[model samples]
Target: MKFLGALDDVSLGRTQRCNRRLTDPNRLQAIRDTGLMDTPREEAFDRLAHLAAELLHVPLTIISLVDANKQFFKADFGLPSPFSETRELPIDASLCRYTLEGESIISSNALADPFLKFHPSTGPWGIVAIIVLPLINPEGHVLGTFCCIEPKVREWTAQELKVMRELTASIMTEINLRNQITKLKTEQNLRDTFVAALTHDLRTPLTASKLSLQLLGRRHPDMPSVQTSVARVNQSLDRAERMIQNLLDASQIQAGKHVALKLSECDLHAITVQTLEELTAVYTDRFVLKAEGTFQLMADPIGLRRIVENLASNAAKYGAPGTPIEVVLGRSGAQVTLQVKNQGNPILGEDLKNIFEPFHRSRSATESAEKGWGLGLPLVRGFAEAHGGRASVTSSAEEGTCFTITLPLDARARAQTRLELLTSDRVAPASDVSVSTRE
Candidate 1:
């Protein structure tokens, strides 16, 4: 935290010995060896210049990468041109020569630096004060100079200088990190594409095997035991297909490649009732729908069904055998709320927040359930939030637990409703068609 004028006497004294070498040719050559001058190399330097100008509150900044003959602007902010030719000046005229000689930040009055005193733009551009620091890559190459220029003689605060240097370091690190991350993502995408293709190729054989098993089960009616085994094989094939589907969905979400929702106004009551009926056949007397209002909300029907089914499946799998898994839906003001309540021992306090995160499960549930991969809740939350709704939970040891989701039934919902009504009119058979009761 050295302030303005604290380094003035030293800097002014240093300025008097202006002919001293601040940086050496060997070091400059090492920086040039980075091959930073050829490929989209300007972005990193320009980013550094912009950041330096912003943070230092200077009128101009340039990330100048210098070589034996010329200085190329890697990045320049508030400067007239991208570069300045070294051929136009004497050997003593390069600002970066001072940077190389000092091997540290060089902040001085341009007028005082006898080296820059002959520069034609120095006075006209009002470049009285300037600070420059080297951009050193991780491999110890001084690739460029991040320098800021001011119009008038201003005291350079130590705090400001420290902040500028720290920013320069961060910019270099970020650029390196971005390059690494981009490469990793590209490699990962290739691997994922290969895995997906392999899965698809393997699925054709699995389907064929499944059909052969079904044919064996049908052709050998006399052997009941053999038929049962074939049926089991069929079930295994179905399970594998389902797993593949889940994997694809997860990959799509990760890669941001999911198809956008074709949203529509869905009858909340119809959705709940239909989902409950489907779950009851699967769970056998475990599902219940407790309605408080006849409400229509805006949502993607397939997505909403998936969310409800996952909730009901969790309740039936973990709750006390005879306890009802309740599906509750209602509308209040501009929001529609849905809750699935089950009389199961509440999850631990610490585990509640983490339950919705991918690949997380409760200790209690893990001990009880033999089959779960801990992806259900995360998928449910993702679907709900994607529809502009939120999923939450409330639990108490004595009262069991309820997971609720809320969605807005505002103008967006109404627009979706109209679109659904129009599509329904066009697609449904006359006998099966009916007008929507949306208000």
Candidate 2:
């Protein structure tokens, strides 16, 4: 009926108006610039929404941010669009606004509510019922709303409301964390910008000094000691710059800034070949990447390369030089693992636990003299976790240390692509394909 269509228009208008207010001509740029959703956070929010949908027995569930002008879906399931404009309704007409108006729950039997009478979203979609639960932080701020829509008209019981409340509580916790991270990132960006400017200022003098030293070196080729001194000064400046960048990286991690993966379905052999080609310049000795099949993995080439680089670099620095550093990729069913092994003084029993922590140096590590702020392994752990996986290290004096990271492929996406293989050929179901191998 026209009711459903009218509601769609109303929602769209409300969303657009909210967007305009939150992102006014000048403020719009800043609002758009603040990218609040990253992969991990998005996954967590989706899980929460799933739980809400299950509890409410609704076909659709949405965790949406209702700003002054627009309704932004942070996560949604069973909905055509994860996002849509709602600029048609004023703030007073919003179910989310009702939550702020001291209502614990906003439910509507769509057929009976005059407010939704013109909103055609209900009848056409067979959605006769709806509810919106406010996701409020402990500080009494409404972050968003967890909404449920059903095709059938049903009564919500106290127990169901309680379950929704619990789910929304978890949603609030996640939002609060996101807010804290947002504030931290705002501060960190400011810090990074200031540091970059300051460093630039300092670098000008260092560059001038280096240039003047080069002139001195040419003028006095007989005095090698003066050249050595200039070289040392140059080295110190370079080290300072590296340290600053490291600090920036640490801040990014703390701010929960993630490097988005440009993933492709590429065979392990190709990835290994590419990794080896890049590693040849730094690790010309014995570097091996062995794998069995042409199994494909969805991975960001750059991020994966960084992970391999860090592990290989660590092995070269701490492990015995000229010894073999082995890289192996293996798959088991739905999981894939990458491991790096080297011969070195194995991790002591005590050091294994804290090795992945930031700024932690292993007591048994022989290369303390090799410069590092102890952020590498922690950074590795963050990258692994970001991909819904983990990084682990095991070592013994006899066998040396082996660092392993296990990552899960995007199963749903893979299922979509591999359905043909499963249906046409006598191939193992994607769920049943397991190849277990270890180093």
Candidate 3:
């Protein structure tokens, strides 16, 4: 074995040039994409590093990735107490940088080699020999290095280098497989969330429609309220259809698709008034509408109506029984604010934060007589945002609960921004109603 001088012996200009060449932007990005840096030491990787040390007859081995600023050890074997506790080292001090520059670097005599002798590991740690093999991905990017270190100078043989290269390939395969599994699990979670929301929300309206039809069947053909029963059945069917549409829109949003809107000059006041009137017909007079200032905006009438309907319905179901639900529509500056206030048990702090998330129902809500799938608030937020606006809620013991939506006078311009913010993790407040449609 021939000894080489330390890495620090290299001239400043040459070292800077080498550093620049090693930090390829695309190569660095590929390293990040592997999702391997700073990960917990896995037994699979540990076994490979152990095998390298054993086969090469060396005291230390490391499976490391050279990040932009640091060389991170994914697995390490045969290191002293304080060094074993270390997870990373600065890039400039890393011998692995040589392997990352695109080939295996082997030095049997570090104290005599110019670059190797000056390296921190060689000088202070007394590492006399080292062999580093690049862990190259299928795309031909050098992600990191697998290396063996010796405290005493030793001869480097062909078989030892071959074994280390083979182990590097195995390490890369495991990393790629782990990343794929992580991605698949993420996608599966999204699908499960969508399914849960759909199944739960559909049940509410379906049960209402079924009960209405059963009541109509028991009534005589000459019954005076026969027409009223038919109306109630129609309302249930309509609600069910709306629920399906909202779910579809939510899916579209998740898929990075836009929520289609029919924009036109519409009377916000009329929409609120009509929505409240419909609720009165179904649930008696538990809702009150208070309008101040002009409530006209360029918006999708149906979307606006759905937003109000969901909020009002949520207030009725969750508010204190016999307490009035207030629907307030007012204008501030160029924005119109629609607030649904209900007096009941205030939402818990944690639950309030996640209320608008799809398929999320607070403990209080789930315990109530009226059960829901937890999509109402999410849909309300989706519709509100689709109109280039935002929906928020405030709840406390003294103030009860209030869900407020503020929309721009012209929503078309901000439509794209709204779509971008509707992520799966977001939760919003919602409303509900039953045949007595009264809470």
Candidate number with the higher TM-score (1 or 2): 1
Ranking by TM-score: 1, 3, 2
- Score every model by TM-score: 0.62, 0.41, 0.53
Which consecutive 10 residues in model 3 have the weakest lDDT in total? 429-438
Q: Is candidate 2 or candidate 3 better by TM-score?
A: 3
Q: 1 or 3, which is superior by lDDT?
A: 3
Q: Which rank order by lDDT, best down to worst?
A: 3, 1, 2
Q: After superposition, how far is residue 358 of candidate 2 from its true place, in Å?
A: 2.9
Best lDDT among the predictions, by candidate number: 3
Q: How many residue pairs collide in each prediction?
A: 7, 31, 26
Give the alpha carbon lDDT tens digit for every residue of 1-439 in model 3: 1223333444334456546756688888888777777788888989998888888778899888987788888898886666568788877677777665476778898777766665565677667888888888777777878888888878898887788878888998898897788777688578757756776778676777777676775676667587667766666676777667777766655544445677778889999898899888766799888887897788888789888988998898888988999899889899999999999999987898999887789999999998787878887787777776899999988998999999999775665344334433342211110011111
After aligning candidate 1 to the native by TM-score, how far in Å is the CA of 412 from where it should be? 8.5
Model 3 spans with C-alpha error above 4 angstroms: 1-128, 131-229, 253-258, 416-439
lDDT of 2 by residue, 1-439 (tens): 1223344554455544533444334333332333442222378878988888876777888776555554556777776631323212334334454444224444457677655545545455455677778765554545457778877668878887788778877877666676677887678779768756776777687778778877887888888898788677776776566455555555446555432334555455576668667667666857888787655666554456667767877887788878988988888887788888999777876578888776788875535668677877877776676555789998887878999988776433433444456557744344422222222
